[model samples]
Target: MSQNERFDNNDSDSLILSFNGDANHEFQEINENLGIVRDVIRNLVPLGAIKVAEGIVIEPVVDYVFESCKRNPNMVFVTLYYARGLQEIDHHEGDSVGPALRDMRKKRIECSELLARELVHKFNDQDLLFTKVLTKRYAFSQYDEISNRKNALDLATRLYSEMGNCGAIFLSDNEVQACVYALWSGHLVPRISRTFPILAVIDYYIPNHNLNFLENFKNLELLNIPRNQYLLDVFSYIMFLIIYTMVAANYNEIRELNGFLEGSMYLLVFSFILNDIRTLQKHGIKEFLYFRRILSLILHVILATDFALRIKHVTSFDHSIPQFHRKALSLVPIFLYWRVLLTLEAFQPIGRWLTQISRILKKSMSYYILLALAFIAFFQSFLVLENTHKRHEGDDDHLGDKNEWGIFALLVKGILNAPDFPGASKLENRFGFVLYSVYVFTVSVILFAVLLPLFMTAFATRRSVPEEYLAHFAHIVIRKVKHNQPTRYNYPSPFNLLYFTLVLPISSLSIIIGHNHIRLYANIEKFLTRIIFFIPMIGFALIETHFVNDKQDKEARDLDLRELPGLPFPEDEKQMLRRILYGLNDIKEQHRSLHFRLEAIESQLA
Candidate 1:
């Protein structure tokens, strides 16, 4: 019979008391059974038979081992070895059995001094092994559960103290989001320092950090990633500005530069279209057609029309007025400004605040609608009064003059304060004069007084506990961004669209035909696709090195100093030591003074 089968058939009382009583032969048998069980577990796949073995064999055996160690403390070294094997198995299985192991440790099965040393040695060895496993696993799969990710981050941080670049691997999107969520939820800020290395890398890649022309340019170089969709929008907007500046200056000296700009603008427009299509696919038509997206669509239309008009103006033989082309180009800046505001949605804090503001405005929409109706009513009243008391063509007071009570002037003056009091009295129609007075009284007094307080109340009611609200908002943002599958979020312009349409599907089919190993196939395809685009990325990185400086280390040091609790002052070593001594002397003097005052009080009491 197999050893496992023989062990299973053994009496439970014999297994338990073999270590408890003085049965040397039975003790040897239990030790052999443990060795066999360990061998079986060590050979099994991490998540495979080991889990079954853990329940059927390992748990009961561990309990027997613990009882035996308790009865004969000299056997504690054997228990430690068994614990080490269990930990190794757990590590391979992603530490899912950690709680059970922790419970076993808490039982505190007895041990001798020599065996205790062995346990400590085992613990140190396991810690090093766990750290290595965590560092490697985090680099490959950071999207795991939060607890595992946190442990990995802690290990990375420790290793980074010993080896500089080891921590950079933990700067994945999942890690950053996790850190941000922790900080915003009132966790200590120092926990996020682990991600600083990666943040520095991103900062190096995209220098300005702020959303501007330079940042858009950097993002353009990263067009292979899906998260840079808004960056493409920003780049297109900047290109519009560039084209506008060129036309306004009438500088056509560098044809090559202009051609490059034009080609880049076309590419950005294509990227914008593909990004929009992706958004539509992910969110569906109803949710996709938000106000900002619609505004973007309108801007693209304007750009397309402007581009066509400019092309016609350039290609035509006749040098005509070009009025329409100029008109269309003039509208570009206005639309571009709107797109810039839309791009701010990617920044978490600002985006959350803007979303709250939008919600408030939506809730208060009826108030604004009523105010608009009131204005319309007042405007119509003023218009009718001005027409009824129309002056003759040869009148001394010209109607076009600023002081004249024209329709707009009357409405503005009445709504602001009251229509010119004397001018209303001088009107030919008494009924018009009375109508103007009532209109001013209704708008300037009742409407203004009522609406101002109503809006204030609405705003006040929306106020919340700032910290809790911020924490909640941050949690939502982290979850949303993490789960949104932004790994494929970027692909530059024409090439990205082609890759999605042609390359991805063909590769997917090949994988299905070969073995139906979906994950392996997808990973291989992603690696190959990224490798193809990485060539240009490398060139971009080389060019970027010229602009990016070595000042990040200094910046990181400054940030560290700022995070320290006390107000820190820079000084030479001698001066700092002198200051510390002086501070100690001051504390001594204060203590002496307090003691003297206490003696005086006691003497008076006696």
Candidate 2:
């Protein structure tokens, strides 16, 4: 691979990351200069048992680490280091240390086996080691355009292999103040399950996170996500999908949606509310009880309450429901569909694009503020030109409006590229027509032509740093991979309802009465979860053991037709799997051919 062919760092002035004060970006960047980082680690670490990586030759580092271990087997000698690769010393400038590191960063397999064992696997939850490991993960983020999901798995594999619990991060025990674990897991693990059977690889399961991980995959075949996160999002997506299907199935007859479909949907809603309540309990009452959070909470309650009592609203209206009720129910699915797009962050390519779009939108906030000021200025100008006189009979304040469209709506439509000049011509306010003309010119000329380009330029700048987003993505996977928080929050949906109503309440009552009457909560919770979610839970349980025992299966693919096992799969599923492999191979060949053509063209042109 050449320098030009390496991953785009988005060199167009968009700073790579610079995430947050907590992210410690400068510390990560310093590690890129290998020599300085190694010396820093060496000074802090004891010599007899130090594992080092930095400016030194990549080959000797592992050997040196092995030698150090032999010298002191009991002690862990971890010294971070940097050096130019010795073997590349005689190579041309194009194949020097920089390019070599870039290549290694992409392939993420060859030199990485030793590096993964040395750096990431042995990592403890110290602040310094945490930063070092995170930076190395970022290096692992560099790959070709198609991407390699297996790259970050190497980091995740080592991480999960070594650590089984999430201890205090940076010596901070406070939950609110310390969101280190939340930050780590939320970014990476859920995403990695896309390609690998991340479910089977981990030794233990974190109940709540596992539930979330399974929720993302959709297919019941691969059920390995840990459970820990409550209803982190405001609306429950799976519930929404189920309810939306029910609503669609019984469209126009809202009263008919009241039977089993309604009951199932309500059950899901109740479970979601229960999860949200538990999440709320973790916070001080002041957090959401105050005016800011209180407002959203109040709105949430009203919406849920309205939907809950919806049966009463529909049952009274003969064969149909009120228009507003029907509209409200339908409007919700639109947002849920949008939520699915947000969840696509678990996929690398989609996640990167979404990240860029978010950055661009965020950067455009100043532009929005500017636009707000413009709107206010023009509206005030229109007010100054207001009149009591009517342009014609029946001409009201919204004479410029088309049907249900208000004056503001009409103006917005025009700005959005669908001008309503005929409607604006009917304005009854004094000088309203004149002001509308000026408004159109100002918005079209000054805003569209001028401000729009500035925003586009900012978009390009934000789009540059693909690596930062990848780091964020890998962090999400690594977080889940490392710690298996054996908390009792692993139940999913309706099953979660069982745990909350019976198991959780029973556990709480035991604590309150000092009776200890409840059976082991974790055991009971697991038993109930298995019974309720037997299809996914049992499937995961049976398959995961083989993966846990066989380390090679992590990267193994059964591509050999002759060696393929026939495991009594249905004929249809086998055919579907074959088609999937065929499609994948076809795409791979296209990419390979295009790459070759590009290389040939470049050689001839040069």
Candidate 3:
């Protein structure tokens, strides 16, 4: 007889002792793993299981699906088990998988014809255990079905006696659902899953998690395998959270830290993939058991970092200095673009205190306020134009003029022409006179061709002019120029608030009037440096805000549309509570028993 048979048939007392020792070690490992599994289950499972269960009359479709799968080893069950196993293997040691495992036996071969003694012993010793151990490991939950028995104790007895191959055992849906429920309910400790799902469950708990519950599975625990996979998931999730938090700080330093976050997330994802492949090889199926766990971690890290970087760049920016000071400022244009659409509507709570006050007083003063705003808008545009013109004529040395601005000096230096400006600077080379000329020409054309026509149209006798709209549009334009003032516009000399209030407005208006008469706006110096850098950044920010608003609107509309379909709506709070209760339910034994028989038959055929 083979050594394995000898060992298997040996005296029971010593074997029992050895088994007990092994079981103890295994239990310790599993206990450690359970900590992680519990976290994952907590994150993944829905919180309102109890309430959902109450409302969730097990539909005929779900029953049919469950029953149908029982007669045949369902793809879902096989896939989940196999995938989980492979992932575990990969996590333990990735290099040992794939071609390595397949070729390992051969690597130990020592002779051309004779069997390597170690290979013969290895095969003989492991083959029996491979069959029995694998079978027991996978079929634990389905032990009853494997033995064609009712009770778990009976099933375990049969398994011990029949000593079947690994392929005969399969976990049932009932067990998985039960375990998930149990974990959610705080009864059972999670053993296999990761923490991401637990967090998802928590988020879900916010809106809905309650359901009607029939069974409570709060005391379950995996006594065999370690929960290392779950631990890894938790570790990765924590890292992802850290990365996201740092990003949220809205500092340049956070973006600079993205490289570290990205690298760590990538490594964790890579580990998960390897784990997945290994599980496939060992379990003989594919499962996403760890897929989302890894993905969630990675996604959170990447998005958080990106968002933080964006916030930092946006909040640190000050538009009040340099050329922008003299110009009026509007947050809308600064952040608007097709790719980065933004709108004040999208950001409702930004300055709602002022907004609320305006709204409250709107009925009494809106028309007058609007009229005054129109004047402000028009006069502001004219003042900006005048300042821009004066700056162009008076400044021979752009560097000297930029230096005078102090804090804004570095930012505005590039707009000046290199060859014509007194000091040769980097901006002159990067943006030559040609680019400047094009910008100047475009602005001149727009002023004469666009604004002039619009102004003339306002004076037309037959048409009722919308002076308010013109004022608002002009306001936006002049506001942009003022916010971007230092790049091209000259500030009033006295620097006092009153002096700024009067001379700036008047000067801006004079430039427009003079341009209308002489077409002298054409001769105005190039503002290409301002055009290139300022426009895109501001435009992009505004566009981003708009798109965000549009997306939110579309989602609300979709939700409203769904409500029109006449589906019964559950009480949100009860639903959430039920989900939590249901998540803790355990029916692994029932599911495993039903599925094991089918899997055994399939295994026989194979």
Candidate 4:
């Protein structure tokens, strides 16, 4: 029972609420996380890449070896494919899974994880591209046979490019895949990133969690616990706005009215900072950080710094710090608006929109990389062309002059559609002006070509099949919410810090204190939390439990979704809906009884 694992305070039944869709691990409960029929193909994809790479190198040598032989060579090359499944013999639904000839369908998981993340192709082995790859992949490169193209690192990179993030990310540490990342040259080298049987890794943190699925053949249920996310979001958002307003007001006017508002904002900001650290403790650094989280962290830091600056300035009366703080807070609006969107993401539609936006931002890193390259090229060229203006006579302050750092900033701004023509207005050299023109035009067109298609594909992703998008969006929201949930310090941020301040000191004291003392304050802390944050705790507590079981938060409480007069069900169709639901439940119970009786009869007959 770790802090982040949602402690049910109200003595409620620990339940798992499926969000937006239904999933059954009914067969998975019976089978020991054995591969589903659909997973075999995806699992073999990596194996296929390995086979192709081997054949590409070995078959050539094998053919040549036969050619050199005097007589007909008796050799056979065979590749066996095995995708074992036994739904009939093992799984719960096997009773109905008759007819070995029956054709089935693969679940539409929109498995982008299986897709290649990079370009993979046949290389000349001696290509300069393998230089770094080889050094990283092989330790005995010089001693190993140089002609053994069959073991080259080319295939590894190719497969990795295809497998992308699907490959063993950090699992390369087992001394297994670590030494294999040598090179792609005409040499015997091991594959750097091992072919992680992407399908066999059953506990791969799937979004639509399967409860009945477990390792060691145990029929255990792993829950994706539902909390009172609505109350949390609404309360947090309201608090966020209040804090934002204080920041917007420069922390002066708010203090004049009530010091608590200004003071509470600091606690909330600190609490958020604590939540992020707890998140990192729970989930290790991934391939990268989320854009929203990064921005939010930056925002928190700036606000925290501003709070510090306010305290220092009040005491010392320094004015310059305000300018620095203002400069940092200027970036807050961007982060703040994005934060608003993140808060709204508890709702399914908005959550999908946020996920899509995040995906677009994640995928468009190549555009940023290209932009950086262009900026470097253009900035250096400008400095070369008109870097040295006369100190006294010419425009010595020209941004392109030697030792000027403004050129770097100017170049970056130019790419962002805010072209700052330092040379256009005050250029002493014609070459400088010509270069600036070329830089602007070249960079703009390059961005247009690169970024337009990157986003065109975004719309296409959104237009994908409903079930696929639903599952994808469902998982994204679940992961995002889970990450934001606090772990270790069950107390949210500043509270966690404060909570530990007392507990930590008492535990370290020399005087022998028994468990009763800790138990006493543990109760006290919860009591204090209830008393202090009384309103939010109540809304959150009352909201988490629903005896009906299949409860959700956002839409039910949304004012916009509430039925208005003149609507299709003007007579309050919810009453009619409830009656319909009652009838459905009765029918469901009858069907269950009937199904059980039939099974009993069938078993007797068998």
Best by TM-score: 4
Candidate 3 deviant stretches above 4 angstroms: 1-235, 245-274, 280-285, 289-606
User: What does candidate 3's lDDT look like per residue over 509-544, in tens digits?
Assistant: 657687453233322221322332243334333332
lDDT of 2 by residue, 289-364 (tens): 3232443354345447558457566557543445556656655554555555554565547667765765566556
Instruction: Give per-residue CA lDDT, model 1, range 262-381, as digits (tens).
Output: 656666666667767776775568644456778878877877786777677777744552567656757867776766665565454565565555545655667667666777886676
lDDT tens readout by residue for model 4, 431-456? 66677778889889878877796678
Sliding window of 10 residues with minimal summed lDDT for model 2: 164-173
- Residue 338 lDDT (model 2): 54
Better of 1 and 2 by TM-score: 2
Of 2 and 4, the candidate ranking higher by lDDT: 2
Ranking by TM-score: 4, 2, 1, 3
- TM-score quality measure for candidate 3: 0.18
- Between candidates 2 and 4, the one scoring higher on TM-score is 4
RMSD to the hidden true structure, all candidates: 21.5, 20.3, 31.1, 20.2
What ranking of all candidate models by lDDT puts the best one first?
1, 2, 4, 3
lDDT of each: 0.46, 0.43, 0.31, 0.42
Deviation from native of the Cα of residue 472 in model 4, angstroms? 5.1
CA shift at 118, candidate 1, in angstroms? 42
Q: What is the alpha-carbon RMSD of candidate 1 to the true structure?
A: 21.5
Better of 1 and 2 by lDDT: 1
Which regions of candidate 2 are displaced past 4 Å? 1-239, 283-309, 314-321, 387-405, 425-431, 445-466, 475-486, 512-523, 546-549, 552-606
* Candidate 4 global lDDT: 0.42
